[model samples]
Target chain A: MKPFPAVLKEKKRYVIFEIISEKRVKEDAVKKAFFREIKSFIGINGMADAAPTVVYFDEKSKKGVLKVDNRALKQVEQALSLIREISFNKCFVHIIKTTGTVKKAKELVKRGD
Target chain B: MKAFIDFVASEDCVSFGKKLGFSRLLFNELSRDKISKTKINIISPKSPEESKRQLRNKMIDIILDPFDKRGLFIDSAFLNIAKQKQISIGISFSKFLRADENSRIRLLHNMRRLTALVSKLKGDLVLMSLAAEIYEMRSPEQLILFGEMLGLSRAQATWCITESPKGIIRRKSL
Candidate 1:
């Protein structure tokens, strides 16, 4: 099958963020919490439109990257802010920055450390 | 750059607020004497009746979250009085952030109603973290995003964090 043209593909934004909590959280928990919160706020169809996926997460640093559809960037941000708890622990997911490229998002996460 | 201020529940979150890029944080604590030491005087009235009474006082810099209680806490008439008195209505983000799924829906409904009323009346409004702990504190942009979700325009949301709070500080001469 021929690959879709670049212009026809959905543009993505990489969000760089870190979890501020008392203890380190497992990557799986973070992923679960994010999906649940986003789905709850934007609903299942909106989640499909946003297409959020956990791209990277460092347990030690608690920094990570999320790739999402560009149009739903603000919706993703609202979802991130609404996330009050993860794995029964009170926490906040602080966004560092959002960029068009995953490489830039990773660089920001490193620089934020 | 715009300067932002947050009305918090304790002194401990001040450092965290600073880290989150807030220029200043005013404490809205249980002990009035503790917060009296500061130049800015803010009042978090318990009931809608108290909010009306406190709005008449020139000594009060802000009225924090009268909508937290269950009832018709604010209306066009209340906003008219607030506007005439140059008092700003404080909307705490944590109240919405911390509510359970059932109550969150109700809270959001009430908040959207308040926002619409404020816009219609052209009343002064401010948004704050009012975080009890560090974890509850959110960045200025996040809070503004919340304001937008509650039916404020982007500019109005920005003003809620910036100019509206600044107006309160300026009125108090702080």
Candidate 2:
């Protein structure tokens, strides 16, 4: 049998944001603001072709997948689901930054959103 | 007199769909509890696995069609047996809820496939306990992604923080 080459992996990067609001209604608005921030400032240049982004939500923390070449997104979301964050109301979204180009992982991370 | 639907055969799904106003209701009577909500059942002479295999085979007959073969329109012909059904779709995490490393890796692949399928559908949001799941998704980001996949300009995608069972105002993401 031909040996399978180890899949290329990329270094991970994260984008964080906080929109201050005393109002509960502002929570949704703030999240939208953050998405706009990422897309306009970072998502377009870094993740134009990206889909299947897995966004995780917990009590005040969030995670999402921006882009990845061969990264498994569903497992990330399911793994997040296994988290017992049912305790915390606020949450996070974790995005797998995959270009499947491990060679460019650092460069991609450095180009901040 | 208020016009109502009557079942000449039985009070099964086609009748229920007429009553409920949805042309079809997504359901899989995998168990008795799943059927309890709907008040109907489809008993097969074959065992569950055998029946599932048979059903899958029948589905593949249609799924293999060159033009009409989008997996989104999966065949749940027998799924119509339940009454008062509200599309009881399950997101199984049995694989991901594991401690072994290899299994965890496998679970991720399943999730990626799931994400892609749901993201691709982009329409057909399920009305859930608290909110409308645009494409079987549970996260705000996916709601946005599905919205955009359906070509919602960036501004049209909106995510409400609270999970409310009250009927959602927007059927699809803006």
Candidate 3:
């Protein structure tokens, strides 16, 4: 078996988003809430296909970066939007930008902040 | 670029929405008297007949929550009228925000049905936050994603938030 080349690999997208709430949130909690909502809304098969991951998160500023298959971008965004509460604090997730590479997404996050 | 607008219930929402990057603000109520202070006015019709009449009035920018009342608020007949008159229909995500478990299911069902109708008829569908406070408002990207979950395509959902309102403003200027 041979590994797929970089160009032949599945396309991925990085989403830069911010959490606005009365209190700050933790990275672990965000991951938990995001997956829970995604599972509930799109079911198990969709969740598996989504393959979402949290690449960057700043607890102090409440900003983070998420990675997922390009095809599941909408599902990931919807899951993030459905997250009303994180660890008992009411909150809202605002997606800032999406890019094909994490470098661009991180740059956008820095510029946004 | 895209202009984001939210139909809010109070004055505080104006500043809140502005902070969140909304360019225009709409005041939503059941009153016929226009709010001179605000640029955009959204009327929440009390009845299906009222909804139809509002949709035809060029002065009134949008008909909010046509499905809020009992029975079919936006039937095929009303949609035809709306499309011809170039009036936009608005749906508030705030309802889904506060709905209970039982009511949430019902709300989803109604919203899915509404989105389907709008898509089929090729009618103007506007997405509004209707946020009373700051936290209730969602970003433009989130709204588009929410629209997709309800059955609209990515491009269609984006149009609901951007072009639909722009068209309303363009019509007002004309």
- The candidate that wins on TM-score is 1
In model 1 chain A, the worst 10-residue window by lDDT is: A104-113
Chain A TM per prediction = 0.93, 0.30, 0.90
Each prediction's TM-score against the native? Answer: 0.91, 0.25, 0.80
Model 3 stretches astray by more than 4 angstroms: A6-8, A103-113, B30-61, B68-71, B83-87, B100-102, B167-174
User: Interface RMSD of the predictions, in order shown?
Assistant: 0.7, 10.5, 1.5
DockQ of each: 0.82, 0.05, 0.59
Q: Rank the candidates by DockQ, best first.
A: 1, 3, 2
Candidate 2, residue B82: lDDT: 15
lDDT of 2 by residue, B91-120 (tens): 222223323444544444433443344335
Q: Write the per-residue lDDT of candidate 3 for residues B25-81, one digit (tens) a residue.
A: 765664688633335567777787788777767666677767752444889888888
Docking level of model 1? high
CAPRI-style docking class of model 3 based on DockQ: medium
Model 3: clashing residue pairs?
A: none
Q: Where is model 2 more than 4 Å wrong at Cα?
A: A1-113, B1-31, B37-101, B111-139, B142-174
